[model samples]
Target: STGGGLADYIPFIIFGAVALIMTAVIIEVQQAVRKIPIQSAQRTVGLRQVQSRASFLPLRVNHAGVIPIIFAISVMFLPTIVANYFNAAPVDTWYYKAAHWIQGNFAPDTTNLPMAITYNVLYFVFTFAFTYFYTAITFEVHDVADNLKRYSSFIPGIRPGRPTEDYLAAVMNRVTFAGACFLGFITVILPIATAKISGIPHNQMYLGGTAILIVVGVALDTMKQLQTQLVMRQYRGFIT
Candidate 1:
């Protein structure tokens, strides 16, 4: 008999429990939105006056999504990939030593204390930075502000022009700070957890939080799109 029993399954159980907990956290943060209230100015129509209406602009909490994760991983792998290409060089050469050092220190699967620390720290910093960078690139505060202003809408107390842009920029920075930290944590956490709990090396752990995030994000987005389509169909049918 192989004598496999509950003891052998403990690691799997712990991993499962951790996965479930993280799934909840990701779902909550993923769906979280900041709703900024706005008011539209009343305007005169051709023959009548239109009343102002209140609305909201919804900003997602996790704005960058998996893009930051992908960017961080790609960056983290680049140095290692380059370093490995120099493996054919003679061991006594400085270039070879430099390449070896680079691979040893920067490789994500590293276990050495100093090396692992360096890898995780840099990986985390890159993830955090990229989250903000990607978010800024995709969601232009100036554009949003201008659109709101053009539509005769103002975010409640905020002024219509440059002030509105400043307010939006401030809000976005604060929101992005939270999201950046979360993204960094999610990207680095599985490797850390694997190193600590499962006795499996970081490189051996193929299914990480990134995979889960992508899967869950895609599923949620698909559901939302499907729901929107159904609602649109319902409205069209009603109009018909």
Candidate 2:
């Protein structure tokens, strides 16, 4: 019985290991940021003059983070959920047949190749779409450009104001695309790979890629906040 129990738990152990690896990879990817060099206008301190100070604006690849995953999952499940309500209809009826079809195809079961393909395709599309959508809403290029202009800071070689905004927008779109692709791959492909490799039932694989992504993304954001707070405290200590 002990040996049998261990064999039964093998799939779960594999799933957990995969989850840990996925989380680590996601966190590492999330930590990667593109730093744009900026220079502040020259200033004077007391009787002496100071040269322009250099700094950088850090832009994260996964700015939208888990929000996109949450949004996509909520949207993706609506069809299956709505179809389930018509389960009581006669099998010969259109609604019953439609509901069954949705349950078989759109539902979150990776065992069926055709259903898995359909579901993953839609999942990828929705996740990618929401990543771009959420990023667009949260990361405002014009605001960043305006703030930089107000602070008398400029990206090296780029003109301030409209040109700067355009440049930032272009860079952000490129980064967002990379992030979205990663999210989609994680959300859809990872679970399928786990099931195929581990010989685990798709329905029983609860530690899916989407869940891992959300967990890791939230952890990374929380760590970033704590680090920022620590930096602020250190700076305050220096000032006092």
Candidate 3:
């Protein structure tokens, strides 16, 4: 009995270790930003000619963060939720069969390999799709272009109007794709890998990849916000 009890906790221990590693990785990725060099047009200040101001536009790779994961999970569970209403139907009826099928295939089950595979596949698809969708909605190329133009700032080689918008959009697309792929991989691979390695049932492994991702993403974001606030307070003190 003691051996069996010890064996049961192995999956949890492995999960905790993986979660810590992933949290560190996510924090590192969140802190990384790509800086785009920009130069402001020269202006005359009274008698002296003021040199152009140099600055940079910082873009985060995972701008959407945990939002995509939340959206994806909500959408992915809809079918299963709808199927629940048909559970009371007669066993011989089509509704009953459909409900059973949905439960058996769409839901996550460690003992059922096919169900697990299908669940992971859908999870990956939803995660990847939502990552791009959320990124597009939140990060508008036109707005960024307009702001840059308004401030008389321009990228090193890029023009100030539509070309700049196009360039920004192109870069965002590439970055978003990379982030989406990483999210999908984590969502699908972690649970299966842990289950296989520890010989634990999927149902028993509660700390899946998606959960770890959301937790880490939220923690990192919170830390960033706190840091920003601290910097603002320091600036305020300096001003006074």
**Residue 102 in candidate 3, Cα distance off native in Å:** 1.1
TM-score of every candidate: 0.92, 0.85, 0.87
Whichever of 1 and 3 has more TM-score, that candidate is: 1
Predict model 3's lDDT versus the native: 0.81
Ranked candidates (lDDT, high to low): 2, 1, 3
Q: Which order, best to worst by TM-score? A: 1, 3, 2
Off by over 4 Å in 1: 1-4, 198-200
C-alpha RMSD for every candidate: 2.0, 2.8, 2.7
TM-score of 3: 0.87
Choose 2 or 3, whichever is better by TM-score: 3
- List of clashing residue pairs for candidate 1: none
Candidate 1 contains a number of clashing pairs equal to 0
The residue pairs found clashing in candidate 2 are none
Positional deviation of residue 92's Cα in model 3 after best superposition, in angstroms? 1.6
